[model samples]
Target: MGRPKQFDPDVAVERAMDVFWRKGYAATSPQDLVDAIGIGKGSLYNAFGSKHALFERALRRYRDDQGAVLVELLERPGPVRERLREVLELLVAMDLADSDRRGCMAVNAAAEVAADDPAAAELVRRMLDRTEGAFRALIERGQRAGEIAADRDAAALGSLLVNTVVGLRLMVRVAEGPERLERVIDAVVDSV
Candidate 1:
């Protein structure tokens, strides 16, 4: 019989998520994952199969944890515009506050490996789709509440907001100050 394994796979995946978030898929070495997860290289492969496999798991973990937070924030009780601003502002703050300047992991993965890797691309696409749907729901709520014009297209606006968020996250990595992000937030929320 095979030897019983040690270390929790869930915790290992969480640690791997952190590593992949900090270092893009191509840049992170297997040793990096082993060191981050506090496991031997053999154990890491035995548990996750390979670096790419581990990365896929890590990306999914990121989706279930960090990615879901945005939807939760959007779903909070408040005016749609106010909630949108709050969620967008919070995301900008988080990205700016990170000392490592690592932007959204899904966005980074999409930029790094999604072109050549179908699995990574699907994961990123699913995240974008989910976020867009949340934004659409919020917009519909606003329209029903008479906060937003009824004639406007909620679905299109949702896509625009998701694009805005993607831009905001990428901008956080290079922004020298919060001024740019603030302007962006103001412009997008006001437009919505």
Candidate 2:
């Protein structure tokens, strides 16, 4: 029989997620995974089957973690617009505060690996859909409460908000400071 494993698979996947978030899929080597996961190469291969398999696990973990936080933020009790502004502001602060400036892992994955990796692409797509759905639901709530204009298209606004966030996350990669991001947030908030 083969030897038993030593590392926690969930913890290893979390570590792998951090490495993948900082380094795009193509740039992160197997050695990087081994080092980040604190396991031998043989152990990692045995646990996850392959780097691609491990990455899928890591990405799904990221989705669950980040997605829950985002949905919670959107679901919080408050004025919908204010809640959305808070969410956007929090994203900006988090992105700016990150020393590595990793931006969103899902966004990075969508840009870097989605075209080539069908599984990764589907994960990213579902993430986008969930976020958009949350935004759409929030917009519908605002309309019902008379906070947002009744005539505005809630679905279209939802799409715009998602696009705005996607753009903001990508822009953070090249941003020098918060000024541009702040302006974008202001414009979006005003539009809503």
Candidate 3:
């Protein structure tokens, strides 16, 4: 064997995720990843195969880490409107609190490379679908509980909520205050 790795692969992926999250796949150089992960270029490629592969890993990590939480949040027991509003507000809080204003990594990835990169597009699509599913289930639950109009289309509303999140995340990337985002969240919750 060549020798044991001096650092953890998992930690490297986490650090790589941060670099990719902040700069995006297209913008992040191989040097940037090496600088962030503190690994040699050859070591990085040898470990992860390539930057694309590492980006995929980082995207998956983001989905599994951040995306799953949104689903769990929506699944919390309570009035659907309240749960929905809370989740949206939580997203807003998170995006605003990020000093780098990195926004959602998945969203940024999609915006930057989804048109040309099928892998990134699919990953982002899945994240959107998962969030949409959560929103749909919550809406259906609300309808069953007599909170939402029985005839309202839950699927369409679910997609709308996903759009709401995507838009909110991107908007906050350049936002100076929370007022517009707060209003948008309130309007979306009311719509649901």
Can you rank all candidates by lDDT, best first?
A: 3, 2, 1
Candidate 3: lDDT of 47?
95
Whole-model lDDT for model 3 versus the true structure?
0.93
After superposing candidate 2 on the true structure, give the runs of residues whose Cα lies further than 4 Å from its correct spot: 1-5
Q: Candidate 2: TM-score? A: 0.96
Q: Residue-wise lDDT of candidate 2 within 1-192, one digit each (tens)?
A: 967558989999999999999998999999999988888898999899999999999899999999889988998889988998999989988998999999999999999999999999999999999999999999999999999999999999999999999999888888999999999999999999
Q: How close is every model to the real structure, measured as TM-score? A: 0.96, 0.96, 0.96
Off by over 4 Å in 1: 1-5
lDDT of the candidates, in the order given = 0.92, 0.93, 0.93
Off by over 4 Å in 3: 1-5
If both were scored by lDDT, which would come out higher, candidate 1 or candidate 3?
Answer: 3
State how far residue 107 of model 1 sits from its true place (Å): 0.5
Weakest 10 consecutive residues, lDDT, candidate 3?
1-10
